[model samples]
Target: MIISFIGKGGVGKTTITLNLGAALATYLSQRVLVIDGNTRAPNLSFLLELKEAVSLFDLITDPKNIVKANTEIDGLKVISSPIGSNAELDFEVLKSLLSFFNLSFNFILIDTPPSFTSETLTFMELSDYSILILNPEPLSVIEAYRALQIASRMNVKLLGIIVNKFRQDAVVSLEYIRRNFSLPILAVIPEDPMVQTYTLEQKPFSISNPSTPAGRALMELASYLTGRKIEVQLEKRGIIGTFFSLLKKLFT
Candidate 1:
């Protein structure tokens, strides 16, 4: 299945895309491919520390370069876009490529630019499912609502929303969002400082620090997607843990 991760910029779409892909591949042993659809400001390559790698643009120029562009990272196949390339993004070509990729990959996850541009729209329209990522801020939720409206208008199949960078102290609670939006809440990833450290170390927290709150949330999401159960040991955080437990009860 092809799933596109969409939201406003700086809301953690790339982070979720990479970590979720890692979780699916490492734990479920699924054949997953993550494509960097944010051609304008691509960061997946930088995070993976892929120097001078073959990119999606290269494959678009010549379809035969598919084997070369499919680079492996932490058991997941990645087709990252050039960091500063000025190549024109053709949505039609991308559509065809995704169709061809369906034959080989169990999951094709796309990380798109954080806007309602043609690139983002095309990716959403092409996807079999789309997940909206947003932070626990009022403005972010408002933006996500706008995105949901657009996705509905486009007749896109929305899987749900993944609330990234979640904080127990945030003014906007998960229950508030649940009451406001019609879409189901898929996951709520906590704000963990180790995420920055892992990114600096060129690793996904899902694989490098699976015990972290963010990592566990991502693994649960992967499990929800694949219907595969994996044991995850949770660490207690006293009041914070109690708060999230309440939220989980509300969600159920």
Candidate 2:
């Protein structure tokens, strides 16, 4: 399956792309290839702690360089864009690249720029499935709606929406989002400070802090994608734990 991740800037789209690839590869034993499409400010290389001499741009310029640009770590293969190389690639080249990648990996996950740029639109058009990332903020919701419209126009199969960075006092409810946009609320990831901490440490939260709220949520998402049920007890932090406890009590 080819699934592309999209959302507004600072909405954790790339984070979802990286961690989802990790979860699918690490936990499910699937060979996953993650392609970075964010050319202007690409960070997948930085997040993965990899320094590649060749990148997707090189591959685009010469398809035979595919072997050199591909990076593998712990079962996950990444195709990175050239860092500090802001040249916009031809959309046809990206489509051809994805077609080439699909032959070898079980899954091809793409990380796109915020809006419906030519590159992101091309990805949406060519992808088999799409996972839209949404944060619980007004502007984020608006951008997500625009993304959804673009996906709909491209006739892409939407896997579902992954609501990122949820908090107790969030302005909008999941129900509100669901009613506004008709898509399954696949997962609600809680806002956690560990995400920032892991970013600073150049580690993925799914690996460094898998028991945190966001980690557990992502694990559940991965399980859903792979059709395996694995049990995990998410460790709760002070006030958030108390809040969830109260909600559980009230619901029960």
Candidate 3:
């Protein structure tokens, strides 16, 4: 399936896409390919610690370069966008590339730009399914509502919303979102510090720390997408851990 992750900037779309792809590849043993569809301000490659290599733009310029453009990182295939490259994005060409990817990968997940640009629309239009990523904030929720409207008009099959960076004292509650939006709430990923730690370590938190709250949530989301049952054991947070968790909630 070709799935696209859509959301506003800094809403953790890339993080979710990378971790979910890793979870699918590591836990489910599924062949997954993640494409950096954000031609502008692309950072998925940097996050994966991918060195200089052929990128999606290379493949778009020459369709036969798919062999060299495809990179393997953390058990998932990736086609990253060249950082700081100013290449014109062609929607038709991108669509054709996705068709080629669909033949090989069990799942092709595209991380799109934040705004409603042609690039974002092209990814959404090409996707067989789309997942909205948003923070639990009023502004983010409003933007998500707008995204849903766009998806509906484009006839994009939206799987659901994944509430990222969730917290107990979030401005927008999960119940409010469920009551307002017409789609299901796929998962609620907590604000885990381990996410940042893993990022600095150049690793996916879902694969490096699958027992973290955010990690478990990502695994659950991946399981939901695959329609497969996964047994993710809850982490045992003792007294010190509970105190720190409560402290984080109190501060953030």
lDDT of 2 by residue, 1-252 (tens): 898898898899888888878877777788887888887778787777754555677777786765564444566777777666768777777778878878878898899887778778778778998888999899999999988887787788888999999998999888889999989988999998877766765667775557878888888998998889755444544446545655776799
Listed per model in order, the count of residue pairs whose N, CA or C atoms clash below 3 Å is 0, 0, 0
Q: Could you give candidate 1's per-residue lDDT for residues 73-159 as a string of tens digits? A: 545778887666677777788889889888888999999888998889999999999999989898898899999999999999999
- Candidate 3 lDDT by residue in tens digits, 33-148: 88888877787876676544557877767766655643445347777876676777777777788898789789998999889888899899999999999999988989999999
Q: After best superposition, candidate 3 residue 104: deviation in angstroms?
A: 0.3
Which pairs of residues clash in candidate 3, taking residues 3 or more apart in a chain or in different chains?
A: none
Assess the local accuracy of residue 129 in candidate 2 as a C-alpha lDDT between 0 and 100: 88
Pick by TM-score: 1 or 2, better one: 1
lDDT for 245 (candidate 3): 60
Give the higher-lDDT candidate: 1 or 3: 1
**Cα-based lDDT for every prediction:** 0.84, 0.80, 0.83
- The TM-score that candidate 2 achieves is 0.86
Model 3 CA lDDT for position 194: 76
TM-score of 1: 0.88
| Model 1 lDDT, full chain set | 0.84
- TM-score list, all predictions: 0.88, 0.86, 0.88
**Candidates ranked by lDDT, best first?**
1, 3, 2
Off by over 4 Å in 2: 51-53, 62-72, 231-252
